[model samples]
Target: MSRVLVTGAASGLGEALSAAFEARGDEVLRTDVSYERGFETGASAPSSTSGGYRLDITSDDDWAAALAHVESTWGGLDVLVNNAGVAGGGRLDVATMDEWQWITEINLFGAVRGTRTFVPMFKRQRSGRIVNTASLAGLVHPAGMASYNASKAAVVALTETTGHELAAYGVTAHVVCPSYFRTSLMSSLRGADTALAEVMSKLVDESPVSADDIAAAVLEGLDRGDELIVPDQAARDAHALKQTDRATYDVVMRAQAVKLEEGAR
Candidate 1:
């Protein structure tokens, strides 16, 4: 069984992913910013065998500790899943510079730090995979989500670059861009735009797909060696339209923009 480390593992997509990996017989390390918050996995707390770490993805020291733990515990890592992220965004004019910086630091740079920390080890092993959770917004920039969109887009770009730069070493990178789905990610939503946050939360709550579904699709994408995995049908369709029919895509995006303007007024 392969050894996998997943960030943001206390709940939501991260929790689902950890369970999914465990179900498949792979050993998983479930980490989050606060282990005190506890995992949904029945256990009130993490045990030594749980391999859970309180990883603040933004901290260099935390990343170092995580790398050391992995090496000392598992001997080596096979997959590094950078799935921890927060939700926040607003129209370009409405989002503060601080908000942009805050979201980007975690959503984008968090993944960057994780990848940078493990890549040297991956190169030494010459066999590893990096899975980063981006969003459909990364590919199809919707209105009122500038901060989130840009951050996720950067993650997509980072994953792509890593794939190319590490191909010779047998290291692969995959970025998951799923549409809104049922997830606890909404809990971390932050922005000056409360109206937009409410709208985004509604979309997430109303989505028929669950985190488990996305996790399964992600696993399948990895199996197929797909670099860009748009797991949800809505995301797939939207991306396809963007690629094949710019006019229709523009109409759709513009209509959303118009609605946002109308709502604000």
Candidate 2:
């Protein structure tokens, strides 16, 4: 059993992962921006095996404190899952500067900081895994999701680079590029610009996957030491499109954009 640290563990994929790891007898440290009432209601943070804490992934000081706490208590961390992210919708031209900055700060920079902080710890142990949560958007350009797609694409690139850099230290990195999963992620998208929110709603209605499936894919990828894990059929297809032909890929994406625009109307 591994000592695992998962960010964004309060809900969605992060919560699912924490539960799955704990069920498998791993010592799991779950952290998020806030604690769910269910976990906090009369449930004391565990001392030995399972635990939870509040963590703001955007804050470097918060990241430092959380890592220090985990290292002090667990002695070492065997797995680090950077799963915290925010969704940004709408066309690039219409997206506000604040929106772009916010998404990049958390979705991209958060992963960067997590990898930078725990890499040395993993190197010391010389046996560890880093799982970065990217998305199918990272592999393909999706209409009206420029910020989200760009941030995840950065994660994919970072994971590939870090995987090679950490290989000599006996550490491996896995990038999870999952398709749309049924979760609060969709609801969260509602917080985006009004027009974009409507578009996101239709996309969510069309997607056919769940957060649990994504959680399973993550574990499977780690077990197999796979660099890229596309959790669902849609994600696999998206990745394949990129492999097939650049011109064909562009044509497909453009068709998708037209479809989304027509649907929104």
Assess the local accuracy of residue 174 in candidate 1 as a C-alpha lDDT between 0 and 100.
97
Tens digits of per-residue lDDT, candidate 1, 115-206, equal: 99999999999999999999999999989999999999999999999999999999999999999999999999988887788789999999
Where in model 1 is the C-alpha error above 4 Å? 36-51
lDDT of 2: 0.80
In model 2, which runs have C-alpha deviations exceeding 4 angstroms?
Answer: 36-51, 190-192, 260-265
Error of 1 at 9 (Å): 0.7
Candidate 2: residue 178 lDDT (0-100): 83
lDDT of 1 at 246: 98
In TM-score terms, candidate 1 sits at: 0.95
lDDT of each structure?
Answer: 0.90, 0.80
Model 1 vs truth, CA RMSD: 3.3
RMSD of each: 3.3, 3.1
lDDT of 2 by residue, 158-241 (tens): 999998998999999999888877767764552345676776666666767778778887888778879998888888987887
